[model samples]
Target: MDKLLKILSENSAYTTAQLALMLNEPEDYIKAQIKEYEDSGVIRGYQAMVNWDSVPDAGVMAIIELKVTPQKEKGFDEIAEKVMMFDEVSSVYLMAGGYDLALVVKGDTIQDVSAFVAKKLSALEGIVSTATHFMLKRYKEGSVALVDVEEPTDGREMIV
Candidate 1:
C-alpha cells in the first residue's frame, strides 16, 4: 500500500501540506496524487469513527448472519443488493463459512432489531436462515482502542 494511503486511512483530517511534510514530497505532488486517487475511486470517502457508546440512547447494534440460496445467474449479488437497501443495515459482507452473508444493523432495542429481521429481512425471498447477535461492548473499532490502557502486569504472582 502507498504511504500516502496508509496515512490517510489512519487520519484523513491531515491537510495536504501536513501530508507532504510527512512524506517528504512537494505539496503539488501530494495534491495531484490525492486527486488521482479520488478520481480513480481508490479513495472512496472519509468519515470519523464515533464512539456511539458515549452517546445517550445512541441505539443498539447487531450482527446478522444470513443463509440464502444463491440465484442461478446472479449468485449472492442479487440478494446482497436487496439486503443493503434497508435503512437498518449498515454493512453487508459475503462470508466463506457457516453463513452466506453477514450484516451489521442498528435499531433502538433488541425487539426492534428482531422485528426488522422477522418482518423485513426474513421476508425476503431466497433466505434460508438468519442469526442475529446483539453487540454488548466495543473494546476496539477500526483499530482505534475504546477502553483505557492499563499498566503492564509484573511477572511475580502473590503467594496468597
Candidate 2:
C-alpha cells in the first residue's frame, strides 16, 4: 500500500497540511494525489468505525455465507450486484471457499435478519444456499480495539 493511503486508512481525519508534513511533500501535491485517488476509484469512501455494543439498542449484525450458481456470461458480479442493492446489506465479498459470496447484514433483531435471509436473499435467482451467523459481540473492527481488557488482579507481586 502507498504510504499516503496507509496513513489515511489508519486515520482519515488528517488534513492535507498534516499529511503533507508527515509525507514531507507539499500540500498541493497531497491534495492532488487524494483527488486522483478519488477520481480513479482507488479511494472509495471514508467512514468512522462505530462500537455498536457500547450503544443501547444498536441492533444486530449478521454474516451470511451464500452458495450460488454463477451465470455463464455474468459470473458472480450479477448476483453480487443484486445483493448489494438491499438496504440491510453493508458489505459484500466474493469468497474462494465453500461459499461464493459473504454479506454483512444489519437488522433490528435476529428474527429480522432471518426473515431477510429467507424472504429476500434466498428468493433471488441462482441462490442455492445460505448460512447466516449473527454477531453477538464485536471486540475489534478496522484494526482498532473496541474493548479494553484488564489483567486479573491476583495479588501477585511484580518480579521486575
Candidate 3:
C-alpha cells in the first residue's frame, strides 16, 4: 500500500497539512492525491470506531454465517446485494470456508437479532442454513482497542 494510504487508514483525522508534513510532501500534492483517491473510489469513506459499550442503550451485534445455494448466472452477487439491503445489516462478506456468506448485524437486543435472522435472513430465497454468534465483548475493532489499562501501581510501567 502507498504510505499516504497507510497513514490515512490508520488515522483519517489528520489534516492535509499534517499529512504533507509527515510524508515530506507539499500540501497541494497531498490534497491532489487525496482528491484522486476519493474520485477513483479508492478512498471509500472515513469512519470513527466508537466503543459502543460506553454508550447507554447500545445495541447488540452478531455475526451470522449463512449457507446458500447460489443463483444461476449471478453466482453470489445477487444474493449478497439482497442481504446488504436490510437496514440491520452492517456488513456482508463472501467466505471460502464452511459458509457461503458472513453477515454482521446490529439490533436493540438479542431477541431482536434472533428475530431478524429467523424472519428476515432465513426467509430469503436460496438460504440453506444460518448460524448466528452474538458478540459478548469487543476487545478491538479496526485499529482501535476497546480495553483501557491502568497505569502501573508499582511505578514501573510494563512494556511488552
Candidate 4:
C-alpha cells in the first residue's frame, strides 16, 4: 500500500509508526502489509549488517573450495547439510564446474578451519577434494547494499 519495502530496506530499524509517517500511510495498513509479506516469504525479517572490518577478528576469513559427489539417494542436500552445521562455515554454495561446493569459512586461525575440514568435513563422506583460498579483502558483498548514490541512472534498468 505504501513504499514500505523501500523504507524497510534502507532502514530496517524504522518502527511501524515511523515508516507509516514517512510513506504517508496508516500504521495498521503497514502492519497488515508487512504481515502478509512475511507470511508469503517476501519480507524475510530485518537484520543488522555487521561491519566486520571494525571487528577485532575481522582479519580472519577463508574461502574453502570443496569437491563432493552428490549422493545416490540423498543428493547435494545431504552433503550441504553437513557442511553448514560447522561453526566455522559462514556460507555454503552448490557450485558448478570443477568444484562441487564453495564454502566461506571464518576462524581465528587457519588451523581452526583446517581441523574443521580434516576432522569434520572430510570425514563426512562424499567429500572428494578441498582447497582453501583465504580472503584478504572483500570489495563488495551481499546485494550491493543500497547506500547513498548521487548518480541514480537505474543501473539495473540500463544493464538489463
Candidate 5:
C-alpha cells in the first residue's frame, strides 16, 4: 500500500499540506496524487467510524452469512453484484468458510432486517441459506474505540 493511502485511511481529515509534511512531499504533489487516486478509482469516498450506540434513533445492524451456489460461468461475482444492489446492504464480502458471502445490513428494527432476509435476500437466485446475527454493541470499529470512558475508583474503604 502507498504511504499516502495508508495515512489517509487512518485519518482522511488531514489536509494536503499535513499529508505532504508527513510524506516529505510538496503540497501540490500531494494534491495531484490524491486527484490521480480518485480519478483512477484507487481512492473511494471518505467515511468516519461512527459510534451509533450513543445515538438514540440508531438503526439495528446485522451480519448475515450466506451460503450460495456459484453460477456456472459468472461464479460468485454475479450473485455478489446482485446482492450489493440492495439499499439496506452496507457491505458484502466473499468468504472462504462455511458461508460464501457475508453481508452487513441495517434497518429500523429487528423485524425489518428479518423481512429483508426473508423477502429480498432469500428470494434471490442461487441463494442456498443464510444465518443472521444482530450486533448488540460495538467495542471497536476500524481503528476507533466505541466504548465509553470510566472513572477510576479505588477499592479501599475509609474508616472514621
Candidate 6:
C-alpha cells in the first residue's frame, strides 16, 4: 500500500510497467492489484493536469467568509445545503475560529458575483453575516508545485 500510494501521489500518470519497476514487483501482479482496486472503487481514474491559466475569459475568483447561525440540533448541515444551491460557489468549507463557512467562488464579473451574494447566499436562512474578499492576484494557484522563496536584497546596487 505504501509503495502504491507513493507512486500514485508523486507522479500519477506512471504506467503499470513503470510502477512495477519502481516498486520491484512483476508487471502482471501490479496490474492485477490496480484492477482489483479499480473494481472495488479504491482507484478511481487517471486525469490530465491542464494549466488552465492559459485559457482566456477565466473569470474572477473570491473567498467569502460566512458567519452563519448553525442549527442547534443539526449543526452546520443545513447551512451547507443552502450553500450548494448556488452555482457560482465552486467550493465551500466549514472553517475554524473566525467564520462558520468559507466559500471559494468564481463569477464573470464583480456585479454578477455580488448578485449571487445578494440573491442566494446572504439571504439564505440562518445566515448571520458575510465578509467577501476578492482575490486580486494569484502568484500561484491550485496543485501547481510551489516555488522556493529566496532572500531579498536592497533595490539600489552598491558602487564598487
User: 56-114, model 6: which lDDT tens digit per residue?
Assistant: 77778889999998898889988887797778997899989988999988898888888
Q: Which ten-residue region of model 4 has the weakest summed lDDT?
A: 140-149
lDDT value for model 6 = 0.80
Q: Give the RMSD in angstroms, all C-alphas superposed, for model 4.
A: 6.2
Which 10-residue window in model 6 sums to the lowest lDDT? 142-151
Q: For residues 1-160, write the lDDT of model 1, one tens digit per residue.
A: 8999999998899999999999999999999999999999999998898888888998999999999999999999999999999999999999999999999999998899999999999999999999989999877888887766674678789877
- Model 1 is weakest, by summed lDDT over 10 consecutive residues, at 144-153
lDDT for residue 18 in candidate 3, whole number 0-100: 99
Evaluated at residue 23, the lDDT of candidate 6 is 85
What lDDT does model 2 reach?
A: 0.94
Query: Which residue pairs of candidate 6 clash?
Result: none
Tens digit per residue, CA lDDT, model 4, 1-160: 3467776776788889988898788999989989998999989877777657556765478888898889988889899998899888888998888888899998887787777778888888888989989777654455543333465676665554
Looking at candidate 3, what is the lDDT of residue 100? 96
lDDT (0 to 1) per candidate:
0.94, 0.94, 0.94, 0.80, 0.94, 0.80
Worst 10-residue lDDT window, candidate 3: 147-156
TM-score on alpha carbons, each prediction: 0.89, 0.91, 0.91, 0.73, 0.91, 0.70
Candidate 2 per-residue C-alpha lDDT over 96-159 given as tens digits, one digit per residue, 9 for 90 to 100: 9888999999999888999999999999999999999999889889988887766457897888
Quickly count the clashes in candidate 1.
Answer: 0
Residues 53-112, model 5: lDDT tens digits: 999989999999999999999999999999999999999999997889999999999999
Error of 5 at 46 (Å): 0.5
In terms of TM-score, which candidate is stronger, 2 or 4?
2
